[model samples]
Target: MGRGLGALIPDFDEDKAQVSELQYLAIEKIVPNPSQPRVIFDEEKMKELADSIKCNGINQPILVRKIDNAKYEIVAGERRWRACLMLKMEIIPAIVRELTDEESLQIALIENIQREDIGPIEEARAYQQLIKRFSYTQDELAQKIGKSRPAITNAIRLLDLPDEIIEHVISGTISAGHARTLLSLSVNEDRINALHKIINDKLSVRQAEDLVRRSMEIGKVPTPAKQAYVFEKESYIKENIWKKFTFKGNQKTGKFVFSYSSPEEKQELLNSLGIQ
Candidate 1:
């Protein structure tokens, strides 16, 4: 069996192996780790990094593990490597260490987390991989990554969202906050409906929460005066404001919806209505 990360790094001192023994390896000989936790790299950011590298060169060396006498697999600094590759750099500085699959994944995950480059969904997937592949518990994974156990638990919970919702979270269409709000709904259909409303109305996290709460209260007895007042407000908004507008609720419970195709359109609609 392969050894755990502690056996290889011993308090992560090995990460600093580059300080004394940095070596310049041919870029062509190094490859990205297949188990790398981060899947998305911002192209604009990569271009910016490449421009900086062209001006100043790589200030930090990449971390790699010797795959064979002739090849190396990157354990960290894949973004730097990509930037260097964009500049067609012939050779790049690196620190090569011997690592098992587990060590490589742990290092990659830690590096990405430290850099804040990986998204929440990707982070959840990484935690899932560690649990399934390495038989790690939530507490153990949290300890390995220096996160609180509840944080790890919450991240993994994101995977239970529908694929469509997960795509929105990954694409920055909705935030992790909005995703968590959706999770509070017990029905999948309600969750999906709320997701549509969130994107269509450009709901903020607080608004999303209110929408979930109102949806949950749908079948309950309505307060007559409050319901009538809310209905009047919805009627007024629909007639005087946006034709796509919708309002649902009773006295203390209600949600407003205004649909738009894009953020620019939404802003234009708000501006047209003299709303800030």
Candidate 2:
């Protein structure tokens, strides 16, 4: 998925330019990244920021890159830009730097992460986008972002989940932990069942994982082919020797037996099976 799409977008990394001077630009002229990872912003939080800017004003300028003579693409501080727009500001302070689309994406992802602006799902999607658009291997991307590889892998796994379950994570119906636990269930129905139980009973992440493990164990009963072979071996000892029987194991190794009443009964039973 990544390599195919990555070709359409130009990509590279150069020495990052430092902020030297602030450039105030028209809000109308500046645009948001079409691939912005964050989809949800807290309404109350936006209001608070807008109110703050209304009175105290923006202390830190936004970041942008010139796309054309009159247009700029936001590289970071989208929330600030949006708030300024909320207040209907004509022009706002920004730091302009030349950046490739790849650099712009990486910086945007990092900035949102540092600010805790995006949720776990959004973070995952952003990581996925970075990898997809720029053809980054998971490990390569992890190194680029200074994250452990497992963190990147786990975040990407969330996207494997069903959309319903994904929405649950988005809506705060479940934590990212619970969603990952749900990923453990290979079957869609099992995942849905586990999700239902998680929400209905309010199960913790550990409990939800336990539920999946237990379900897997129940499903791991010996295959009928193996069971039939074991039962056939038991037939060799004595056909219909006893009404009650027990068997445990698989093809290479296992146990088969029935209880005897007493010492005499045990000996008689063994003798009946042609034991010395």
lDDT tens digits by residue: candidate 2, 211-248: 87887888531122211222344433333564224455
- Give the alpha carbon lDDT tens digit for every residue of 1-276 in model 1: 023245433465555433337799999899888777775566678789889989998888888888998999998888888888777788999877777777677677656665656788888887787788778799877776678999989999999998768866875878999999989877676787788777767889999888888878893212222112224464465447764565555577988767643334457579869999
Q: How much does each candidate deviate from the true structure in C-alpha RMSD?
A: 13.4, 25.2
Question: Lowest summed-lDDT stretch of 10 residues in model 1?
Answer: 221-230
What is the Cα-based TM-score of model 1? 0.72
What TM-score would every model get versus the actual structure? Answer: 0.72, 0.68
List clashing residue pairs in candidate 2.
Answer: none
> How high is the lDDT of residue 218 in model 2?
85
Count of backbone clashes, every candidate in sequence: 0, 0
